[model samples]
Target chain A: MMSARKIIETIDIRKIYGMGEVSVAALDGVSIDIEEGEFVAIMGPSGSGKSTLMHILGCLSRPTSGQYLLDGEDVSRLNKVELAAIRNRKLGFIFQSYNLLTRTTALRNVTLPMVYDRTKEFTPEESDEKASRILEHVGLGERAHHQPHELSGGQQQRVAIARALVNDPVLLIADEPTGNLDSQSGEEIMTLLHRLHQEGATIVMVTHDSEISAHTQRTIHLLDGRVETVVKNGKKKPGKEKVEK
Target chain B: MKPIEAIRIAWEAIAKNKIRSFLTMLGIIIGVAAVIIMVGISAGTEAAIQEQITSLGSNLVFVQSSFTRGRPGQGPQSGGLVFDDSTAIQDEVEGVTAVVVEQYSSETVRVGDVTLEEVEILGTTTGFPSVRDIDIAEGRYFYDLEIERKQKVAVLGSSLAKELFNNESPIGKYITVGSTKLTVIGVLKEKGMVGNTDYDSRVYLPISVVFQKFTPSFFARIMGDSVRMIYVELDEDANLDSVITQIELLLAKRHGVSLEEADFTVTTQQDIIETQESTTAAFRSLLAWVAGVSLIVGGIGIMNIMLVSVTERTREIGIRQAVGATPNDIRIQFLTEALLLSIVGGLIGIVLGVGGAYIFSAFSGMRTVIMVHSILLAFGSAAIVGAFFGYYPANQAAQLDPIDALRYE
Candidate 1:
């Protein structure tokens, strides 16, 4: 019987920036394993390479030298078209800037990924319906027709999240998802990510705040293009807490 | 994305900036309208020229006497072939139908109560009306007997009659030509002006009467009753070249010279018509070229506006790109917007151009005609210009870097 795992492993991943004399290593010899249905957060300061590791894991960028097996398939050496396909099918991205089309409505923003996924056959009406439902799930159902400029920053970020989830991706990768929001809006977005994780969706988020990382079941700390440590929270095994303590 | 969604997005973008879109389309409108109007004017002028040429009778040929050199110090010297050359043509040419002789001189005339100013007086034979394709509106034309007897009879052109008799009929009344009193036998129908010359304001009489009464000394001193020119009518089935050759031979034999020194130039009316058509065709092509330049300028204007629009929407392009839109989508969107602008402008321009042509024709009394083929050409060229000029800007928009564009304010 096969194990139902959303991700397999990463081995000796290295990413270098620039070339020749001015080269800088953004990620060096980084490796980690993430299992199915886990909410993990990567914490690091500026220039610590957490964003570079997240980009490699999300298939947004390629590793200079590494092995990354996503669902037991080697994804490190994939070509551009194959990487795009993997990004479309398995990875969903939530940006810190909330890059929604300015003049377009929330529903249209949500339906954009489905437009790029040409192999999936859905009529325009069905796509719109699915976009509307996802917007509703993100708590922007009534604001489906509102343009990005008309919505608040937090509401716009939620719309971006809805757009990412509309493809039903297996791994949700967010980079500084709530960095630009107020405390209340940031907490709300984290709660939304927590709820999505509880529904058996695998999530990997990058942030600089320890308090934000505390909401996840596991935290990975990185320093100077290397992973410092990985810590599992006590809640992962509530029944064995007394024995372990 | 579905085509309908792209169209909707384009329309929304256009609606957002209505004034800018309209301003961009104005160039196309003016270009198309200018093309239609210029072509209409040329067509009108060509039609007018053809109508005038046709009215002069296409089958009639003119034979004018040529003069050899006389001394420069000689006063009022005259040398030309005589009326016998006309008779020779009639007798020798197989295609000859009717030959008429003409002598024209400006002379003062008088009636009962009014002494008219100097006007053109044509002296011709009884076959003048048939050869020139003119009709007598009232009374009868002079017969051959009248020409042979040297009777003083005249036919008044419609305007000449109006000038001499007012509203009263002038047939049978006498009008003085130089010193001879001639009786009016008929009134010619009204003929409009051609090439700014008034043909209806003239009088006609027999060549015999004019030679006997007005210029007796001049005619007697010349070879044999010489006149200005002779007009010949040919059978419709006869070859014009053969007839011309035979007439040239007869004229050369009669004038005692070779074909080159025959002292006459014979020209068919078809030659005049052909010359006029080519001249008008040249003018029409010139007008079309001027209009084409305007259309090119309009195309450049579309390109300028599209470049501006692409620059203005760089951030929007970046946002779309970030949301997984391919470069193709960006290209198609901008191209569709430009196409819609030009097509709508072209349609409006066509309507205005046709309306302008009709209005010009009605108000200015110029015959303006709009051809269907010209309209199609204008419309098709406008679309091609739209595509050609809109392509570069749209490609520029499509090739923009998403990362750099997002950084643009």
Candidate 2:
């Protein structure tokens, strides 16, 4: 029997920058498959080609040579407009910088994906209601009317997370979601991600910190445009458990 | 995105930068105002010209003989109207009001010790004043009996009276035109200048006497004996074309020429007025073109400012694109902003330009005529300019790469 699940399968994805003598390969034959309801972290150092891969997965950029299948449909060959539709419907994004429109309220930011999707017409009241509900889910119900600038770094990141989740997309791809926050704010954001994962959200986050990777159930380590290793069910060792406590 | 949301976003964006938006709209304001003001002034001048022409007289016709066969510019050769044609016009034309034959000659006139140099002496019958709509200020004009009996009587223009007689009542006095002496029977009421020619510096006399007394030898040069030009007045109810055709046929037979070779030019006052109106309309259109060019320059200014705005708002565009705004939305937002600016500016300009035109008419003593059609044209052109000039920058804003835009500072 076929399973009704959202899955991303990338086959030998290769992305290159520039050409001729100045050729630089950003992604070199990297392939990974993320199953439904999985919380996976892509960990890599600077210049590890992880962001390029993330950009391709998020539908922001097309891979130079690859087949990216979202739920078994080949999205790699789709046009820009079609890809935009897929991004609107199937993928949600969280950025480290909490990319909210500076002049708009938190509710307006959350309603943006629905606006792009061209779904059921949402009046201002309807958009506000949905945004408030999503904000409530993210523990930010009280800050619905506030602008990004008015919120703390952790709160702003949560707002970004709420905006991403408002569309109820199949995959949440976060690019360095906690990179710009303080350690405590980062921990709170990670806890929120963990709670979202437990609520059956499929998350794929990119981070450079190994400590942050420990929170996720699985970690994919990338080095020099290649996946180095994949660790599944990364529980703490008996000797390291005492130190973590 | 919905159009309402797009409009709201555009409005909000413009509202956020109120000073910039207003400054950008200033170009459209000045352009619309210039077009309206220029058109208004031209219309006013045309109205003034029409008024002046109408004041001269309506349905009054002038016939001047063309010297070179049918060609108009061949000096004044005679084979034209005779004194008998004036009588024939009154007798033959059904709507003929009055007929006055005139022969003009320049001569010096003297009264007492004062001499007026180079004064125009008009030779016509006593019915000239009534036919030409001139009135007497003092004494009385010559009677019909005086004109039939070849009496040497003159009616002095107001300026001529003032120059020769000063403040004294010169009724029953005599003035000498060249070697011919004439009695000053009346002083004409002051008639101001017409088309910059001083009408109030002329004298009038009987046509029979002027021809018999002065320049009797001049008639030997032309075929047939006649007055130089015939001024005819038609009844208000008469069809001008019928009269003109009848007069043309009669004059052709009288002159003993074929229909094509009839030496006289007959025209009605309506012809002169129409010609003046068309000429003024041409001038008005030329002025409108100049004003329209300025509007184009103003539109260019709008385009330039919009381009700058697109550059300045690159990041905002990127943010919108990132969040799901299509390129079409970006284009519409900027275009709508431009249209709104131009529409508001155009309305303001119309008010100001119309008000300015009225003020000019009052202060400068010129007739101002503003037509609704011209106002509509000015406003419509302003909107078109807004759309045409606003399109490129809006398209550029729409075509910006979302990735590059998001990274824009």
TM-scores of the models, in the given order? 0.81, 0.76
Q: What C-alpha lDDT does candidate 2 achieve relative to the native structure?
A: 0.80
Q: Write the per-residue lDDT of candidate 2 for residues B238-329, one digit (tens) a residue.
A: 88888888888887776666678768888877887788888888988887887788778878878998899899889778766765667887
CA-RMSD of model 2: 6.0
| CAPRI quality level assigned to candidate 1 from its DockQ score | acceptable
- Model 2 shows how many backbone clashes? 0
Inter-residue clash pairs, candidate 2: none
What's the CA error at residue B167 for candidate 2, in Å? Answer: 16
Q: For model 2, how does the per-residue alpha-carbon lDDT over A116-233 read when each residue is reduced to its tens digit?
A: 7676677788878988999999999998889888989999999889988877888999888999999999888988887787777888999888788777768999888999999975
User: Which regions of candidate 1 fall more than 4 Å away from where they truly are?
Assistant: A1-4, A7-19, A23-36, A40-93, A173-175, A204-214, A217-245, B2-5, B63-85, B101-124, B144-167, B172-184, B193-198, B201-230, B250-265
Model 2 TM-score (2 dp): 0.76
Model 1: residue B69 alpha-carbon error in angstroms: 12
Candidate 1 positional error at A158, Å: 2.9
